[model samples]
Target: MGGVLADGDRVKAVVVKSWMASTGGLEVHYQDGLEKGSSLKANAIQQGLEEDVHVSGAQDMETVVHRPAKRSKVQLGSAPPLTDSARLLARRKHCRFWENSGDEMELELLAAVGRNLQPGTDSILLGTDSHTCNAGAFGQFATGIGNTDAGFVLGTGKALLKVPTIIRFVLDGEMPPYLLDLILQIIGEISVSGATYKSMEFVGSTVESLTMEERMTLCNMVIEAGGKNGVVPADETTFKYLEGKTSIDYEPVYSDAQARFFSDYRFDVSKLEPVVAKPHSPDNRALARECKDVKIDRVYIGSCTGGKTEDFLAAAKVFLASGKKVKVPTFLVPATQKVWMDVYSLPVPGSGGKTCSQIFEEAGYDTPASPSCGACLGGPRDTYARMNEPMACVSTTNRNFPGRMGHKEGQIYLASPYTAVASALTGYVTDPRDFLM
Candidate 1:
């Protein structure tokens, strides 16, 4: 599906199954631009196409799925149960809510829904968040759609598209020491917008070797590079990750052996090094060592990119071995509430001792009050340990763009969790190798 086409190109496409329904609401659409055709610009007062379409969006639908089986009578990691207020809203909106399911990010749940739970042909995951591309790791044609597209999708269950040029990354070695760093380095080299409106198809031995979660991490950042989506062909790892998660029968899709591409990138694990994106832009990259002189005011070690177990393992190696307390306020966040639970209760990092959460606490860090998006993408400057004063931060989040985590004035250095935890301990951007045992 990694194809490039003109802006107005159209082809015959069909929606085998329809997902969300935009039955009501303001029927909001854009007021201008490429999406002008999609926008309705309607409000309760205005008479537009919205009223003729029956108003609200995704409200009270039988087909829409709710996550975690609705009001799951379970909780974890000091996380509060689904509040009655939240339940009331979900009930009114008719949207699926994974109340107390310990999932902070909906990507996994959505992936399970689209790829496994209710597998179907010509499936697309329309999400308000940009990370909807995460589903592409399952070899699905997934991407974030603008509000205009949402209006159209709800009406017809189909979308018009400009097929993007596909860029392929072929690797032939074992995984690197810091795969997160590898992705950072690659993106830095390509620079943001290098693949604008293009697709990134990861292939080769190393990609195949990566676990589904790792592969998702690799592809999840494609959007950060200004690509349409990043995907891996369905393989053994895909099947294993989906086993028992879904019983739906569906056909898997893959690229051709001799598939053509707009460009190809080759890399060997032996030669790559850990890297970070300096302030203002993710593409402004440098090795962690190169930016060691940059002092850090705080460290953030969670996000979809950094909150996974694999990411924590790298941080744990550095944190556990150093056996020291952090000098600055460091926010330790797990991508999902389930990840929070696993870190809180389960022993990890191939070492037996305190739980991951306990270790972080002993190291003088606070678990996110709730397993929800905290301090990422410009969270409230006052709460969540967000940086208000002008300071520098070493973060494991996907972006280092101006004011990403907190105050726009704060400088953010985007790096791996390994680098972030180490920098927090040293009170500066310290190299992870200096701390890891």
Candidate 2:
């Protein structure tokens, strides 16, 4: 009823009637009407409501209604049936809903669909989740939109978007082991709102040498700095990551040699050190060592931004190297089931066949929790690992704003996986160089 009638009267009438029959009356609120009407139409076709009800769009589309008999087993396959033990463990760790979404996190969902879609080409990706910009690592135009736009995309497979001005970041030095520090430096220099409504384009030798995971981490944080999107040009590294993930034919695009930018910044990261964002803001940058005098109540390592398999491996490398148990209660939540399995199955390269889970255990840490967003979203009060009282925490999550991880009065220090693990080992905001070097 809300989308364009793409065909003759028969099809249009069926869609409109099915939507009206599914729900009584019309949705009149401007934004709600746009979304609800489009969604109802989609549901009509997807659920075969057109076959169940026979009515015409011209026949009082606002008045007719139909309600189907309730199914005996509603949402039977919506989520996996976890065992009582599994459910208990998930609750204790505050992880849930992997079965409902198929994938545990939005980043994983992007991988499943846009892994092979080339950027700079005629391809576009729109997600309801803000971090959809993460796919910019593969050189694609990806960004987040509201439910109204999402519903429109659902009804029709196209969307309208304005082109954003670009800001180029030229990174040309040997990168330090702590990648998060680089992003923190940029955010600190530009402040959170500096890139508002602009695309941040990363290039130069350092970006070219980064792994896909590292590139994704950088692009994922663009939204935190008010960026519309972030991009890293597609190269052999991007193509290699796409191999075996998708078979779709896609053409790659690149910037012109004389492409103009709203602004340009250059950084040589060879001398960088681990950094963190203090509580109440992500751009409040401070060197990890500068905050070593600050004690923490816990350490958390999870979320789409910092809970990838590679992130875990970086933490495990610190744990194995230190050969020390965590001084604080360290929590682990992998971002997806695939990453959870990898922590248990994939061996650390120099750990004599030890997996991350084993290394974590040896370092007196709990087994990696089930994969999900967990406490990073500050979900329900009963969420596992959620901070229930005022306390300090060092997390690998990208955000450190007040109440971001649960309690409004709690303090959060955002750091990279390496810095998070190192701080966990010492119960303070310790620099990763203390261990990594």
- lDDT of candidate 1 over 1-437, digit per residue (tens): 22322233322211112321221222222211222123232322112232222212322321211233323211111222234335445545564544333444654435632333222255555666677777777887678887788667655657887888899988778765544576687688788988898989888888888877777777778888998888888887787778876666767767777878999999986677677898888889888888878877888887777777667666776778888999988887777766766787777655676677777887898665555556777776565767778889888888877777778788988888888888989998877778652
> Which of the numbered candidates is closest to the native, going by highest TM-score?
2
Candidate 2, residues 1-437, lDDT tens digits: the string is 34532212222122344333323222211122121223232222122232222233444333322112221111111132343234334444454312223344664346533453565778777778888888898888888888899767656667887789999999998987655556777887798998998999999999998988888888888888899999999999888888886676788888899999999999888877788999888899888889999999999998888888899999999988788999999999998777888899999989999999999998988678888788997989988799989999999887878889999999999899999999999999999888877
Report lDDT (Cα) of residue 397, candidate 1.
Answer: 80
Q: What is the lDDT of residue 136 in candidate 2?
A: 90
C-alpha RMSD for every candidate? 14.7, 11.7
Q: What's the lDDT for candidate 2?
A: 0.74
Off by over 4 Å in 2: 1-104, 107-109, 112-116, 178-180
